[model samples]
Each structure stands twice: as structure tokens, then as C-alpha cells.
Target: MRVSLCVLLPFVFFAQTAQYTKDIEVVKVGVIFFNNELELVRAFDTAIRDINELELDVRLEPLKHFVSEDDSLTLQEFACELIDNGVAAIFGPSAKASSDIVEVICNTTGIPHLQFDWHEENFYIHTRNHKLTVNVAPAENMLATAFLDILHMKQLDWKSFTIVYENSRSLGRMELIFGWRQVHKAGIKLWHFNRGDDYRILWKLVSSTREKNVVLDCPADIITEVLNASIYYNMTGQFNQWFLTSLDTHTSTIRSLNSRQFIAKMVAVRVRAYMPPPVHDEADVF
Candidate 1:
């Protein structure tokens, strides 16, 4: 009886510990940024601190590794480990492709994910909708609208548009639907739309673009393809600079971008205020 009580006592202690730990709905955060660069790392960390204020139970655990072409598998593995460790929610990896991987893991694990700006098909569902994914930032549709607004504001009356996209994931297709709506919003028209590799089609559209402009939503590696094509056709100056979406600002890609090679363009980006926890009310749990 004495040995039985001793063994039973440890089991009881373990149960109490697990139950206590599970009571809180941890708003777990996961991010994929250029971890080696202090600027990107610090900025990302500070953003999470602000998020902690919104929910008393929220916590952030940065996936230490960054995402690059070579490191994607590593990052994916680390993220799964985080999910296994009982993360209740996820955030960051703001681009569509990377976020899709996270979305799949969260769905499989029965955890909720909140991708910030980029929304993939069936991944983002609003909190009000009672779905697993949420997006706090503007959607790609909103991003396309912003670019169209820029054209209208500048009163660039080119009637034709060219869309460059990738379908490695479904994000490009989703954006195409929204981009057309943006064109309609500007009272303009869309021309040749191209998707996934093979930039030959774009040269054919340059004559049309000689009168208008084009929109490019290619990923980092593929952005160079459009840049080369625009230069090849000597249509670089024919239209407004190609527009892109904000994605992982990795070092190698930044170094690869030469202003002389491709005309400078603006991407859909956000200026977020990164604040730490409230020191003023540190004593109050509420």
C-alpha cells in the first residue's frame, strides 16, 4: 500500500500540472523574418509585444531560423515543432506561400493561424466567421486597390494592364480576381494576363503597354524574370513601374536587386508601430 500511494501521488501531480497548463488559451505567435539581421529581428519582436497587450494570455515564440530558398525546409520543421509544443495560434510569414505551409500544419493540428497581410485561398477566415485563420492586415485585394488608386491619383490614363503571377500556390490566382476588380474600380481596362514562368507572353503585350502599364505579383526569385523581360522589350519606360507585393525581405534578394537593372517600384507594405508591454500598468493583470 505504501509503494502504491507513492506511485499514485506522482501520477496525480502530473495530471494537475497538465490540467493547469491547458486551462489558458495561449495566443501563440510564430514569425519568419531575417533572423540574422538585428533590425528585422528587433522590429518583429517589438510588434509581438504590442499584441500581448491585446490579450492577457497571448505569448510569442519566434522560430529562430529565417526563410530563404535553402532554409524553407528548416523553417517548416521548426514551425511544426512549435505547433507540437502546444501553440494555440500563429502569426507572421506575411507572404502567401510560406503562410500556406503554416496554415496546413495548423489545420492538421487543430490550431488557429492569423496571417497578417497575405491571404491564401481557404486559409484566412475572420474571427467573426468562427474559422481557424484570421488576417489583421489588409488583404491582397486591398493592396491591388491601393496601386490602382495611385494610377488614378496620378491620372495615368493607360487603358491596358498586364498581370505577371505565379501559381506555386493559389495566391497568384486569387490576386488575379482582385486585380481585375481594381482595374474596374479605376475605370480602366486589363490586357494580357500571364501566370507562372515563361515571360515570352509579356513581350507581346509591350505594344499594348506602350499605351498603358502592367502589374507584377511574382515571388522574389521570379521578380527578376519580369525585370529582365521589361528591359528586353525596351518597355521599361513605357508604363509606370511594375508593382509588387511585400514579402520576406531576405538579404540575398535585397542584394540581388540593382536599381540600374529594373526601374524602382513600390510594394504593398505596412508601417507598424512596434511597442513593448505597458510599463504603466505592470501590476494589473487585467
Candidate 2:
């Protein structure tokens, strides 16, 4: 139920190395976002307020530029605008594809890119300049370790499991899990549940496979639907087990999950952890 994520030295260095004049100092940062997440918006505003209250030598001016999630040209144009306006760092645009585009633009402009999402495996194969990419989220390797630890704790063989994911971002985890199997000399099947697919059909397919152990990596909003479908199909029992890899699972209703007709066997893992700031301090880390 508990998870931890640490922001390593590289990010600290970026924050610490902010330049300032003796009389006046300021750091401009840009955020690229496409989703309309009220909580995320609140957090960003909260961060600015906290930073101001700290009365540090340097001040941070954060600007958010929203764009269509799938518009590559718009992403590039907005990124260029941020660079042109003298942003020291850029954060977000959580989608993998958009983040990748923003990353390339940041790298070209030598701006530190802060990301909280997954990166494709192929992107890391090169040894080029990654000095500008600062990921606040846990590293992919850490996720792999956590996942493997879960499987090991459950004493389940890799071959006995199947991975079901929502989109491309989830593919990163799938690939890591697939790679981990090489170490164990085992392999597992992979399935994708697209946005509009019928959950009933998906449940039937899953049931037909007779695969008891399933690792589901999907958005929090879809978890309830998946569970409900499973319940309808009588897929909840000792014979079936589900491992959810979504952080927001903790926020789900416990009573609904513990319905009278079915005994749900589920365990979820969150990849991010928040640490409290020092006593009497309002500063926070993300």
C-alpha cells in the first residue's frame, strides 16, 4: 500500500544552480500540459506560493502552456516559445509521445526538461546528451524492481502471469517486465485494452485464456470499470488474482471492492511517494 520515490541529485543541482543578481533574481520555468486535471493545476499554483513564502534568494515564475495532446506541431511551437522566452526548465505534458517531442525541443535549447511520465526503452539506447532531461518520477529500472519484487513476494512464476495495459505509456512497463523474464528464463503474454473496446468481450477473452495472474497497468478512472466487468463475469475468486499498477488505486472505494457477491483478490502498487518537509516548513517535493 505504500511506495516511495526520491528525486536524485541532478534535480537538486538544477534548483541549486539557479543564477541570481545581487539586488534582484528570478528563474522562469514553463510547463507543458494537455490534460485538464484540477488537482494538478492546484498543485502547480501551490508550488509557486510555497516557493514565494520560502523567500529564497531566487524567485520562480512558472508559466503553463496548454496544447492539444496529439498535436506534434503545436507541441514543438509551444516548446520553442518557452525557450525563446528564457525558461530555465520545462515540466510535463504527461503523455509519452508529447513528452518525447518536448524533450527533443528542450535538449536542442539546452533547457532542463522535468518529466513525471514514462520514456520509451529505445530512446535510452543512445549515450547522447541526457544532461538536460530531469525526471522527477521513479526511474524505469526502479519500477521494474518494484514489479519483480511483487511477483517474487507472491511466489508467482513469470510464466503464470499476463500483462494488460491501456496505452503506449504502459508499454514501457510491459517491456521492462518482459525483459525481467529473461533473467528468470520465462515469458508471459501481453494484451492491450484500447479506449473503446468492449469490456465484456475483453473479460470473456481473459476468462477464456484461463490466466489467473494478471498485471493491469491502466488509468485510475478505468479501474472501477474493469473490476465491475470482472464481477459481472464472476471473475473474482481464489482462482483469479489481479495486480494493479496505478497510484490512484488507493483512492478507490473499499466498500465497492468488497462487494457481497464476490470476494475480490487484488493488490495495487503506487510508483510515487511524497515526503513531508521539515517541521514548521511549508516546502514540498514532487
What is the C-alpha local distance difference test score of each model? 0.48, 0.65
State each model's C-alpha RMSD to the native: 13.3, 6.0
TM-score of candidate 2 on Cα atoms, chains taken together: 0.75
Clashing pairs in 1: none
lDDT of 1 by residue, 88-176 (tens): 45554545244356666666677666554445544334333325555555555665555556444444344455454454343443444
TM-score of each model, paired residue for residue: 0.47, 0.75
Instruction: State the lDDT at 74 in candidate 1.
Output: 68
- For candidate 2, list the clashing residue pairs, or say none: none
User: Candidate 1 versus the native: TM-score?
Assistant: 0.47
Q: How far in Å is the alpha carbon of 58 misplaced in model 1?
A: 10
Runs of candidate 2 exceeding 4 Å displacement: 1-22, 35-39, 96-101, 124-126, 154-159, 168-172, 175-189, 251-255, 272-286
Candidate 2 lDDT by residue in tens digits, 85-187: 9887887766445446777777777887776555554555224545577665656667776777777663444456777788756665555567666522335
